[model samples]
Structures are given as structure tokens and as C-alpha cells.
Target: MAETKTHRVTVAQRALLLSWAGVTDLGRRRETNQDAFLAEFPLFVVADGMGGHAGGEIASRSTVERLQAVVSAGDVNGPAIEKALEQAVGDIADHPETTDEGTGTTLTGVFFAITGDHAQWVALNIGDSRVYLLRDDRLVQVTTDHSVVQELITAGKLSPEEAEGHPYSNVITRAVGASELTAPDYVTIDVRAGDRFVICSDGLTKELTDYGIQHFLREHRDPGHSVDAMLAAALENGGRDNVTLIIVQVEDEDDSSSPIEDTTE
Candidate 1:
């Protein structure tokens, strides 16, 4: 199922409009769907659970449940997010069903906030899940994968094409649980009207290319439509893994002007 909601919030005393929708599906090959997400305002997240059976499901559920408390209390920042992850770590460790050494989940998404006097978008990531930004009719990936193939590509030892088919493509170097605590990489960007963000697990990318994602976003103006289209397409293309998606679009409540496209820092 897909859900859409609009939020009116203030950032640096400036009111902004934030709208988003999210969806998830168990692919053709997975016996258990071990993915979870939260698409609430100020925070939108997707987590692709790893390990096996109940392990992945518990890890993912614990993660979002912990983060959900943060959202309820309205303290969302790097440290706060880290604190939530710490709680999630504990949740996974205590779960009796999660015994696999590889049990964990990928957490990736963008959040809206006010830093100092300006409204900002903060993107965070761990593992192979991704975040992409669409502005000025161009879509660009905002998060880098922490996986074996990514390391090879960064070291100039593997081509992008070859990395796709490599046997180590699914091996992630970092995650939220699985017996280790790792910090997620965060990129802050200026908030702008007409800017859209796409957050998803590796399952979506495994089925759809960046170009395909861009095309679907262009084809749909509403968040709900965009999410449904992409989810359907991912499954049609052979959803080999559990797929998840979140579409977030920002707008200035006071103006209908075009979005400003600035490079993220």
C-alpha cells in the first residue's frame, strides 16, 4: 500500500510545504519480506533488513520502531538519529529470534529541518540502500553504497557495468545492526521548492536503473502515483529482493516558483 500526506511546518521562521508517500513489496524470490519504512514529516526512512527469516524482519521492525519514538518526541538530528540507532542496536541484540550473525538493516532517507536560519534537507545512509534528488529536471544519486562492489569501484578496480554482475555485489560493508555500530554518512542540502527526493532499498535499484527511476518521476507529478509506478515497475522487472520506496517533494508554501538547484554539501 501507498500513502500520501502534506505537512505544513516552519523552518527558520519560514513556512514550507512538505509532501511524501511510501510503499514496500516482497519480491518474487523472497520467502519473507524483511523491509520497513516510516514516511512521516521531518523524517522519511527506508530500511532493508538482512540476515535470514525472522532475524531480518525483527531487525527492521526494531529500527523503525525506535526511530518512530524520536519522531513522536520531535527531536531529529544527527545525534538524535544516532541515539535511535543505538536503541535499535539494543533491540536487535535482545530479540530472541535474531540469532544470525549477518542480521541487520540498511537505513537511508532524507529529513527536513532548520539549521541556524535556513531550511535544509539532511540525507543519511548506511549499507547499499540509496537516496536520490530530483531538481531542474535532472536526477542525481545523493548517497553512496557501502558495499564490496562500491569499494572496488572507488578503488578503480571495477567498472560500473561489471560491478552490477559481480558475485560480491550484495555484500554490504556497513549496516545498522548485525553486532556492530556504524555511523551513517550525512549530506546536507538547501531546501528548495519543486525539489523531489526518492529513497529506496537496494531492491528497487536492483530492478530499476537510475534512468528508469528518473523517467517514472517525470511521468508522475504526485507522490503517490510516482511511488506506485516505481513499485510496480520494480516488481515487473523481476523483484529479486524485498523492495521499498519513499517519494518526498518539497514546496514553498508562500510561493509557486521554480526550485533552486544547488549542489549538496
Candidate 2:
């Protein structure tokens, strides 16, 4: 039910422009993959599905597909983006194929654009899947998790360390298609030369430490290699959940050195 105007995205006047997505099946326990992802011009997403049976896959796939279609049709800005996300949620809630407790999905998406001398980016999400900005050697998480533990941390009811091992650590308060509609938090960032962006699912974050992520990004330098290192670290730790990752780099046209380009899924 999501609607939007059709618009074509033109190439940016930058030294590099590319997108990428990676996914792993449900780790050690589950027999099937429940996570879904997408990457294309101007858009990237990672969805973690939740529900019993195959409903998890349905929720994640539905959210990603609807979001991609709407963005492909040019839906944007806070209001349009919000509506499109709600519609995606509605689609999952209304899905006839869903056989389990109404399915839910964690969605995080990034939209990129270049206009004149400025490069713009938007990060939006409805659950714990995250978007991060890496500059110089510091890594900053741009999206907040909607989990109960995160809320407790925000409300000062629990310390960061205690919340990590809390009983409700995995309980998210909001997710796509879990309710009639869902609202996602949105943040716009000014992209600069030498900025690297990453969007990923909880699978990557659950196993790898933030320092581990920063170290890989700083040391590997290559987007593909960085993703590889992150995944390798996660698999080594246990690979307990479905993993998805997308890496993007921003550089000015004059940067003498070039970075490897990684295409999307």
C-alpha cells in the first residue's frame, strides 16, 4: 500500500559511489535464514525477521521489498519516508501467507544523494539494526535500538554494562509489521570526503565488539575487506544469529588514492 512518485537518481560528482549488502543464514540453531536485505542506488536496508515458523522470513522480506519499491518510486523526506515505512509494516501485518504469531521485522535503511557541492545521507530504522559512521578512526552508531534494554539505558534505569546482560535484552519495543503500523526514527547527516558508512543487522553487533568494528574499518580500509573481517570475527565468535552488512565509502574527486568498490545485493 506504500505510494510514491517515480524519480530517477543520477550519478554523483564524486570519486566513488557504490553500495553493498551481505547476509548469513540463521546461525548454529535455526535451519533456515530469517534475515533479508537490499542495496541499490540511493537505498540500503537490513531486516531481522521475528516470528515462529517461516513468519520471520516473511516479515523481513516483506519489509525490505516494500521499502525498496517505495524508494525506487522516489518517496523521501521525514513525512513520505515515515508513511512508506508504516505501509511496509501494514503489509506484513496484513500478509495472508503469514502463519505464525503476527510477524515482525527490524528495519534499518540509508538513503544517499549528492546535490551540487554537498553530499547528503539519511538513516532510518524501526528496531536494533544499526547504521554507523566511521571517520578518521572513530566509529559512531547513528541509529538507536528500540529494545527494552536500550530504553532502560536511555531512561537511566540500568547501566550500559548491566543492560547488556539483562533478561529483556532481546525484547524490542518496536518493529516493522508487528503492529498496525510502525514509525521509524530518522536522522540526516552531512557526508564528507573520507567518510565510511555501514548498515548492518544485530547479528554482526551481537558478536563483535565496537572496538573490533572500528579496528577492522581502520585497518582493512577496503569496504569488502572490512565486511569480510567483521563477518569472520562474528563467525569465529559463534555466528549465533542471521548476519547482514552493507558498506559505503565517501571520497572527494581529488583524493589521489582510490578505494575498492563493493556492489550491492
> Whole-model lDDT, candidate 1?
0.88
TM-score for candidate 2: 0.84
lDDT, candidate 1, 1-265, per-residue tens: 4768998765434466788999988999999899999988789999999887799889888999998999999878899999999989999988888888899999999887665545678999999999999988899999999999999999999999999999999999999995999889999987777889999999999999999999999999889999999999999999999999999998775665443333222
Question: Which ten-residue region of model 1 has the weakest summed lDDT?
Answer: 256-265
Model 1 TM-score? 0.94
Give the TM-scores of the predictions, in the order they appear. Answer: 0.94, 0.84
Alpha-carbon RMSD, candidate 2: 6.4
Model 2 agreement with the true structure over 189-263: per-residue lDDT tens digits: 775557777888888888887888888888876676777778788878899887778777665456523332222
Alpha-carbon runs more than 4 Å astray in model 2:
1-16, 19-21, 74-80, 99-102, 114-118, 256-265
Which runs of model 1 end up more than 4 angstroms from their true locations? Answer: 10-15, 253-265
